[model samples]
Target: MTIRLAILASGRGSNLQAILDAIAAGTLDARVVGVFSDRPDAQALQRVPEALRWSRTPKSFANRAAFDAALADAVAASAPDWVVCVGYMRILGAAFVQRFHGRVLNIHPSLLPKYKGLHTHQRALEAGDAWHGASVHFVVPELDAGAVIAQARIAVEPTDDADALAARVLTVEHPLLLHVLGLATAGRLAESAGHALVDGQRLYTPLPLPLNPT
Candidate 1:
């Protein structure tokens, strides 16, 4: 069965493009029901039809909680089996998370357990890490501390700068999210007690993607 997706993005929507491309190429069995953004001018909204697009500035609402309540209602209206946050900039509140608890997913540009928030590439370079990459995981309340489903790794070269490292990671990240979502739509992936399960078994470690060309 094809799964319906509700995407939340706040930027260029490069990852959203990957999903769209995959579905168009007949590689993914999913349909994008809607695209939601917190920023009125977000480029991501342009990728979907006008009817499937929704945006509301936080300033229009009294507070963050109020904004989230409206956002949750909009997302629930689509009845999405999965909610994928691509470049969504807002931090989701507890009310929104609990509403669709086990169904939210996010892809972060780091090895995770290292850099949970922004500037991951620079942080890794400064720390002299040998490897750096992106991780696709379940989105829980505690930032990116949820169970990782899979990751795409890239070696950090001695000559690499933050920009260079980030560019390299982006190449693999697209495929990484697609891979994880493929399993999800196929009924081979799930979340239980904040843990990731694949093929009905616990995923002790995130499945790693082999290195691709940078």
Candidate 2:
């Protein structure tokens, strides 16, 4: 069965494009049912049919809860088995997370449990970390605190700056996300008891990225 996905994005949507490209190339057994964004002008909304695109500025709503409620309803309308958030900048509310609960996933630009919010590349560089990468994890209301599903690792070279590190991480994030989604589409992954489950077993740590070319 093809997994239906609802994408929530707030930026250029490069990862969103990756998913669409993978589907078109028959590398992924999934279909994007909708693409929603908090920024009305977000470029990601253009990747899908106009009817499948939903967007509105957060300021248009009375408050964050109202906005999240509305956003959740829009996403729910798509009936996706998974809600995938890529570069979605807004912090989701508890109510919205509870609505979807175990079915929402997000790809963060940091190794997670590390940089939970923005400026991840700079944080890793400042800390002199030898490694940094992206993580695909369940999205709880606590902002990247959910159990990680898997991650792609890239060495932080001695000469690397924030931009260079970020660019490199972006390359790996695509493949990492696709790999994790493959597990989801195959019915081998899920959020179980606040932990990540793969093939009905607990994921003790984020799985290393597969050896496929990125």
Predicted structure with the largest TM-score when compared to the true one: 1
Across 1-214, the per-residue lDDT of candidate 2 in tens digits comes to 8999999999999999999999999999999999999988899998888999999889998999999999999999999999999999998999988999999999999988999999999999999998899999998989899999999888888889999899999999999999999999899998888999999999999899753332
**Which RMSD values do the candidates have, in order?**
1.0, 1.5
Give residue 189's lDDT in candidate 2 (0 to 100). 95
TM-score of each: 0.97, 0.97
lDDT of 2: 0.93
Candidate 2, residue 154: lDDT = 87
Clashing pairs in 2: none
List, residue by residue over 1-214, the lDDT tens digit for candidate 1.
9999999999999999999999999999999999999998999999988999999999999999999999999999999999999988888998999999989999999987779988999999989999999999998878888899999998898889999998899999999999999998999998998899999899998998998645
Could you give me the TM-score of model 1 versus the true structure?
A: 0.97
Compared with the true structure, all predictions reach lDDT values of 0.93, 0.93
**Going through the candidates in order, what is the number of backbone clashes in each?**
0, 0
Residue 55's lDDT in candidate 2: 95
Cα displacement (Å) at residue 159, model 2: 1.8
